[model samples]
Target: MTVTHVHSIDTAPDPVRWPDIARVPSGVTARFGAPIAARLFRRAASRLDVRVALPDGTNLGSGDPRAPLMRVHRPAAFARRVAADGLIGFGEAYMAGDWDAPDPAAVLTPFAASAATLVPRALQVLRPLVLPGQPAAERNSAANTRSNISRHYDLSNELFALFLDDTMTYSSALFGEVPARWDALEAAQHRKIDRLLDEAGVGAGTRLLEIGTGWGELAVRAAQRGAHVRSVTLSSEQQELARRRVAAAGFADRVRIDLLDYRGVRGEYDAVVSVEMIEAVGFEYWPTYFETIDRVLVPGGRVALQAITMPDARMRATRGTYTWIHKYIFPGGLLPSTEALEQAAAHTALRTEGRLGFGSDYADTLRLWRERFTANADAVAGLGFDATFRRMWEFYLAYSEAGFRSGYLDVQQITLTKGGAS
Candidate 1:
């Protein structure tokens, strides 16, 4: 027998040759180690024209002039985790305290801005591979729905109330021309509802149905505009609050909020609207969702669907920082691609009338929420919630702001009218 000696890099430490490092998938391979990593780094450098204008330069690691404002960490098993699982692994690593960056938003912003960088990065992040099948769970079962909604909405209304506007609307971002005024958010939300109603062309006495109405903002606004409003939501807290608001506004008869699914809705209406709620319907249920909307919308009626949309198929499922939202904030939620939404409505009599994208505004909206939440932290904590809950919410707001800033998320208002029904 002949004995062969193999030198292990862990013991030898001669810059740890590429071959000695653990194997990683091809995607991560392009971003790690000397040769390939250097190429990728050079590409990023040239693209970003890497520059840091620091006065004292004390904020950066190593205080190296060439690497100002940049910190690099090469964890031994980091590449392996990112390569094998992509966003899921990366997120887990972040949560498990495996990775640290001084400014996550600043580090990710430049990469997000470049289309060339984003395309390849998205592909690398989304490349699919087969794995052993796990046991199937029941599809949108009642128990599942309750658990999903409760994970986030049922936490504590008082906590949400502290940060949210007076109406307690908990949907997509609100846009305003000015940033300083709190009423700007509320005004923007009402304006959004008005825009939806105008696009729907609903006149006085017209009947309207709103699916997933949060806090009755839209429903009450539509009712005030002289359109009878019927709204539905899964959250009992939302339903009760909305009901009280509607009654107080003297539109209890005109605006009705029901704690039910859209599929349970009956009667035909002149218009339909859903805001920021469609993401929770999941991709598998989009067809049913569209069908339900179409069924209750009368001939020649219009439907306005407002929800966050992914720019591409790769983003349809939550990724990176958004996985935290799925696990802790919005379990079972999935943003839909524009194509998927269009395809879901294909079988219906509806046709797209107008579309608007508000991806940038979401960044501003989230930042505002984070500031408000932080400002009112003491009051929110007084609502009998633990520190973990507060931290969870803070993390939620910060991570969401990061996502919107990165353009990995979007908010879209899609207007649809029944086709061939004029």
Candidate 2:
């Protein structure tokens, strides 16, 4: 097998290969692996609200009143993948054009609903047989965190602008009240940010610290409320744009956007806010991540965190697997469970004050992003991205949407306080 390190690119689409490890399964894993899992997969689909059309022109789970349809063009390769790696293979099938779905998220929702029980309970001990361990190169250490972040966050501002809302907030949005319009994404993002700031008690004379400044929108908004803000990020591309945006907002005097790691910060602040940033800290460093927040926060200081969480059981099961998402999108990132977050905070002075779950909002947010991305495909491809790159992004967005839609994942806005009573 050929081993080439392909990055989440900004300059150009990665070199396309027959079996690109960066995006799809490779060699034996792509072909001669497992057919047994394919048989089980067919059985599993029979229980869900989805239709799978095999290459033989027959269908599985037909007559489902409310399921999505998937057409397979290559059954042999698809079966091998599903047998070898389970869900990862299914994603690769989409990336490889082995399968097509009118509604990709819909096709995935049922599987996500049954993910925890995909394999028999007695066979759970053999998880490692199909799931691979975390890659050594992608381990989230202080030294490698910057590179891991750069892999995704540095992948061109032009590329992101093609899909993200005007605020450039890549995290989940809070569309307060249902029956919301699709175009309300930016407003929802602001609402989400404001809620976090309010929870952190950021206001006139407040000192605010923000980790993971994506183009500085949060810092600018906080500074607008007369707060002095310090925002840090390891992404050079992100920090550059954030600095410019902060200056453009006329908050350069009050808001400082720096290219620094959270572990390197020097001063204590009255409030700390990080929106979906902890997901990138890796499970191993979660304790240190929380400790840094605690140490830099003054006594009675408040923290507002917007995080993506999975059920604790799911988190534990997949924590060791280096997934396709890690290989192609986030590199070293890992979503945390609320239970894991609380456990990590056990050694810190921070305690959860209140928490709100809004997984549906994230589903809506992802749907909008995916639609926008699909609509702007021409502009995206015009940026030198190829067909393969485009498909990968589409799958990433749709996959996330399905995760939220299936209730397999959730987003939370949590308020924490220093030396809190809990």
Candidate 3:
């Protein structure tokens, strides 16, 4: 496999790669779908507890007077957007300044809670006809995986550093207690890593294989436990930063950060641990993901996987449908349900040992990140991101937060052992 080190982009990203984000809807969908969308949205909003404030001074929903409010600035444009793209359009409308909300996440929570039933049954049947499918070029093939990963992770190292904690852990942090405090984030991150390591049984002289290296924090922690770590990732930007962090932590000798796809990984390890990286594997490649781990692990070796999950029924409902997230943020990502994950593992020798779910902790983690990102808006702009990009990012973060906050999504740490052995 060819290895090329990726560097931070100096200027704004290429526009051709993001055609939909900055687009203005017109033509048939915009003209015809607007009025239809307006009626549908009003009907849907009335059922949710959140308040929707329209330009005509009409409010939908029977919630308290102070309920989380979604203020639609340009009702026609907002309706047209929803008509054209569904939830993706709603997000685009926010980026286009057609809507405003003091707390977007709060306003989005009730809608997320009613996700399965938000759209009328008649309209839900038209989803396959209306929504786009995953782009063929962005599929999780070995070659395409690099491009998919680069589209997001390789955007800029400094960009992520603005909102992420000092550890640079990108996945969810496991908060220690209820109502997680922002100041407790770094400690909670360490606790999350420690728990994964413990589950994988990493120790002195243990050989560890990490499928995703998010800036080397996990590798450094593993090396600190006297384990030899081989961590792989497809993102060049991540690999470069992770290597520097490992060396700075004085574990350069114990840790190896490689810019390699997981499918091509070759090694025999005592334990394999992957943090929330499986989402990018794509639903079709799930079996391959686990089988690779099984093939590379020694007998009785353990695996710890942290993933964002949805309900099994919901997973089946939305598997092939593309959304705002796939178009703008995570190109090839698809969250798995607990049942789907187990079924994938069953394809290999790995058997589920135990699992822990703390989705609310993820909601807290995202809240902090969003707050920090909003606070660092100037810094983000200085880094050369445009307002549309910022809004897209804000919506992405808040959208994800709402997913967990509403119990529509979950994050789980699952442990698996080879040969069904304890």
Candidate 4:
């Protein structure tokens, strides 16, 4: 069988000339096989504003140069991959080190929203599920959790410290009630937790269990409100840091941090709250997860389940880049559509009490994190991480922000109560 070679440009033009943009490095030209791919590159780059200079005059293409970012690989291949696979290919290529942009979502947002772009991609995606390996739903064992969390969360706390707020809360978007004060985001998070507690009707001296607690923020705050809190997490680093924070805040008597899986926790509590943790649990385990919550909550107890959920069936069909997130970020992770959540809870004793959608605010929250991350790049690099790790993180934040901006993602606050509650 003869090989059908496709030649493509490896990088954007050197900010020198327009027509010269199509020129590929000799090595890249030889690797990609020439004229056909070169023509493809020229055509694709012509359609995008792929070039920009940083304040210091560094040439960066396909993203904001001053920010931690990357440019898509040979514009032609990126076009073809996205035209064929939608966000999956875009993310896959980035993870595979094939191509990159300052923000992968910057490259993807425009493509995802365009009917012209998606029509071809939808057709191509349907042609074949080119991804190799088992689907996340098929590999639902607990063994997968360690590696998955480590890929993103196991990074040094020092690195995260550079980007996250002083409190070190790393999950979901914060809701800024004031919209003007810098502390509004943290205040919003506290207020949201307060709302969860109020909806649960859990008062002073109530016992509470928190699943997937990050940095013990909710637990610490809840304890301050007079609730006894027990929190669990899969990350050892998070466990240690949260324990320290809880102690520092002098809430050790009220807040307990247990390094255990959510499935193993056995207790009856007045209230159970899980914030942004369900997505990482994957769809295959939803039944078990919900059952665990139902089992742990006492009769008339409340469960606050906050997560980032997709809105509808149509969005579910378009699973974004399984490759990048699976390999580099949250592995074995799947975002549940709202319908899926309701279906999972249908047979359980838990009843929905309060539901609020905070999807729009995530874009702002992510943007803030991006700004914080950008402002602290030197501190991040000083943490002894290499360029690749930095690039991976930058890509993660920017792409996520873009996803929120495009409305392909959502952040939701859902409160459920046992039988006999309002």
Candidate 5:
């Protein structure tokens, strides 16, 4: 794909100055914090397996010849960014071309692996002075949820199509092997969806409620299983494409796509299925999310949920903090731990029946996505997204891939049953 015209980068300016997205600490705070952050980063890097190369011909970390190499282009800027916003600034620095790596994911994995202990316990207490809380405007309230969803999902349907597999599934795919091939991605996605459908017991004449309609692939699959489906999403772009895809697949009669919030969904169903949707619901609303599902799910019905989960300690620690992801990728999102999900369900009639985690598969999936995205950079640029936007997207994908690669993040297909079914 080629571009006839490029949109102004000014339209999507760098988010470094976005106070709601990332807070630049006061001069006094930065004066003290920058040196502290630089020292801590150097100390942390010295122990990691990777190598960090500075412009002054100095290298940190173990200097393992086989380890990934992180090259810092503008050290002072990088230090100040990290001091100002922590991880969020780290990402912004990447977007601003302050640092780079031959393989960004490879360089990020070790850091993600040591996420819990990167800063000393004493220094971690200073996090509140640097990091900002989740912006109230980005919260998952009934009204704000739509805007939050629009920010990412509604960017452009065509933009997503450029990178995703033919199945158009955005969530993780369940690959059959460790190193999955690109040609098998569509099949892997189908397999993942099939597992969810099977766990939900969706079959002939069954009524299904899907909380997130991602380009309608899942809905079509459910309809193919002889289930009547109602799918809801906050993205108009996704809804439009999903509706067209459903009609094209001849499942339009069996599926109904609605531009509605999950909280506003008003029907009882045999099965309730949501894939990676719970993350968009803020931590404070998790109970409400499960309660809504409980209210709509009939007794004896199954709820198959695909969720991206982090460790409980990590979730609790970061739930209220704004990060790079919140700034440039997904806003108002928080990954729940397995324990947290179960606790949320405890407040409702839903009980966990089973759970299967495929974090490695997600890592593989994201690697493929990142590769494809880079390969299609021109196409992405042709879609009018500027260079900074491209860098942000690349960093977001690499950052996420590294999380899964290091086991800092995980994806789980969890089965829940109404009325405490065993």
Candidate 6:
């Protein structure tokens, strides 16, 4: 039976939902702890332009009307979240209906802009005292990688299709200098993929290695150019769909989509490409990741990496903080700084050829995704995902977009060459 179908509109799986209701509470800590944490939040935002409104109609901040407003419906719950989970509680509070921000991105923008200065110098030194430890199980060890990847990637494909464009490119789409319409999303995604391919110098007879096979667009596109591509991924759901897409596009012979982790991948190739996959490599494993690429690539082989990056100082500050994103969205992920990449490259068999940051493009991409997701909220809930899940995703997308909007984060496509340039 030949399966050449492209896009099948399949119903989502009714997977077991979140809110581990079985877990036991730690102690009476949250009872008294939440209020103290709420006061700290008030103190932190006191100088920021944004206002955090209380139940009594009083607010915290500089009282700037131009700034975004956050309504705390249940300060106790919001504070309890922060007190117990630290950063994770912030987003959880929203899911629990403790807070409301009509424009999350807008409200978050000011906070994101002031992220570097949120804690004063005197207080920053006490961060170890204030912050919670990263979950030991969330660490991206060889044994634990697949579980971490599955928790997010293995979530129903139909859920993603509900919001993503026809191309199904989940990462940032480079919509170019001028703001493009929603219709240009698929094309923008192609542009982004094509740019990475072009930078990697993929063409006929070029043996390409893609570290993270998201779906099959990149593999199919590369194969269309007569390149033989071998893409690797750990996501079972992603691999199944990617392989199906590859077969559908008649690229089964040219493109091999393997369910293999980067740690175990074998073979040397002419070009290596990984789109926004480096974030999952973990800070401790960065060197080994680069080394793996170095070992797999032939001499003069080109490498193009599309990565989400944060400022060095911010990365330093939040690297160890178990945030909401780690808990609910992308587990075991950490955005690296440009300097971190350069520092790692300086010691590896790779040298940077070129780098392009498209943080604004990501902001636009996320905005469109959020809008689309919001528009299809009913359909999403119909897919067996609860309201809490929808709001969690909404916050994830908006929070990410805000990070880019505030220039606190960026997405860069860096081109590198083995043993320097050819």
Best by lDDT: 3
lDDT of 5 by residue, 90-136 (tens): 98777766788878888889999999999888867867766799899
The C-alpha RMSD in Å for every predicted model, in order, reads: 10.9, 5.2, 5.8, 8.9, 4.0, 6.2
lDDT of 3 by residue, 304-374 (tens): 99999999998999988888889889998899999998898787889999999999999888988888888
Ten residues in sequence with the least summed lDDT for candidate 1: 1-10
Candidate 6 ranges beyond 4 A from true positions: 1-29, 62-66, 420-422
* lDDT sort, best first: 3, 5, 2, 6, 4, 1
- Model 5 stretches with alpha carbons more than 4 Å out: 1-26, 420-422
Model 5: lowest-lDDT 10 consecutive positions: 1-10
Off by over 4 Å in 1: 1-143, 173-176, 180-183, 316-322
Best by TM-score: 3
Model 4: CA > 4 A from native: 1-73, 76-89, 92-107, 114-128, 133-138, 174-177, 180-183, 314-321, 420-422
Q: What TM-score, computed on C-alpha atoms, does each candidate reach?
A: 0.74, 0.92, 0.94, 0.77, 0.93, 0.91
TM-score of decoy 1: 0.74
Better of 3 and 4 by lDDT: 3
Q: Count of backbone clashes for each model?
A: 0, 0, 0, 6, 0, 0
Cα distance off (Å), candidate 4, residue 60: 17
lDDT of 6 by residue, 1-422 (tens): 01111111132212345442112124465667777777778887787778888898888886778677778887777787777666567777766657767677777777788877765577568667766767889888998889989999899888889889988899999988656568999999999999999999999999999999998899999999999999999999999999988998898999998888898988879999999999998988888889899989999999999999999987887798877888788888899999988887777889999999989999888888888888888798798876667777888888898899888999999999998444
- Kindly list the per-residue Cα lDDT of model 2 for residues 265-324, writing each as its tens digit: 989799999989999999999999999998899999999999999999889878988787
